[model samples]
Target: MKNLVLGVNDAIYRACIGVAGLAIVIMALIIPWGVFSRYALGQGLGWPEPIAILLMVLFTFVGAAASYRAGAHMAVNALSDRLPPQVQPFLTLFVRLAMAAISLFMLVWGYKLCVATWNQYLSTLTWLRVGLSYAPIPLGGFITLLFVLEQLLYGDQHKRRVVDYECTEDSKEAV
Candidate 1:
């Protein structure tokens, strides 16, 4: 059962990484094309900037979830580290609970925001619904919530091979 859950998470994590990577790659191509078309070709394109912005949003939210699962998200542990050993577990629990709360907030409020804006469309990209632009928020929140639950149930996955590829590679090299 544990292996099944971890395997599922591993697939999800890989998908997140791929999505974020694709968004970045497309944005990189789109931005340069936009610049080149505007300056060199003497005709500005309307789609690139908005598309890039949307991709950035996707990258940010999705990448954030991936980072969290991998324990790569920014966290200042100075205060926690200085605390007594016995208090550390409590602090860890507190942090996880706090993350769960934040994830829930994002899921609920973001879905509300998306629904509220569903009827509207982006002015620059007439076919694209404004709500669609906000989809990543709830999606990312849900993904992160899954990861948090996994942590609460199974313990920290930071050392997992899927999450820490570099460490795995180093260990392989040592062997």
Candidate 2:
């Protein structure tokens, strides 16, 4: 079950990153052509700026999805590391709960924001509605929450442990 969840998470992250990367590439090519058309050909591209901005927004949010799944987000481990050996389990539980709360908050807030803007259209890009702009927040947050839940529920202790050894001379020790 844990493996299946992780597999899904990895698939989502990779797909989002791939799409965002393609968006960036298309944006790069479009902008240069738009510039050339404006300056060299005396006619500006009608939608370059709008397209670029949209692609940039997509890149950031999609990249966030990937980061969350990979556990690459910035975090403070000071408190966890400072706890005594026996208290680590409790601390881990607390941290997971806090993360779950954050994810839920984002999900609710983003949904509200998206709903509020549903009727509005982007000024520069009339082709896009405002709801589309805010959609990524909830989507990314949900994916992040799922990833956190998987970790919280079934994290493997053996895989998480640190091993250290100092060799000592002994009669039975191999050279």
Candidate 3:
């Protein structure tokens, strides 16, 4: 059961990285095309700007989930680090609980927000539903929630090879 869960999470993490990276690459290309079209071609393409914005939203949320799993999310540890060693465990548990709460909020509210706007379509991109753009919110929340559960149950998986490639490379550099 443990291996199965870990394997699934590893795959999910990889998928998140791929999706976020692809979104960034596509957004980069789209923005440049928009600029070129507006200034050089003498006509601004409405689709590119809105499309890029949507891609950005996708990137931010999906990338955040991957970041959390890798233990790369921004955190201020000054206070926690200063606390006595014995209290650190309690603090860690509190932090995890807090994350779970935030994740739940995002999951519930984000889904509601998405449903509320489901009927509306983007002004520039009529084919895409406004609700679809908001999907990453709940998706990210759910993914983060899974990671939180993994942490609480199995402890930090940050040292897992799939998530710690940078550390592996750094060690190679030292050799």
Segments in model 2 whose C-alpha atoms lie over 4 Å from true places:
76-92, 156-175
**Candidate 2 per-residue lDDT over residues 59-103, each given as its tens digit:** 776776566556576768898889898999998778778877888
lDDT of 3 by residue, 34-105 (tens): 999999999989999898888898899889988988999999999999999999999999999899898888
For every candidate, C-alpha RMSD to the true structure in Å: 4.5, 7.6, 5.3
- Candidate 1 local lDDT, residue 114: 99
Provide TM-scores for the models: 0.91, 0.73, 0.91
Error of 2 at 17 (Å): 2.2
Give the Cα-based TM-score of candidate 2 against the true structure: 0.73
Q: lDDT of each model, Cα atoms only?
A: 0.92, 0.74, 0.90
| Backbone clashes in model 1, listed as residue pairs | none
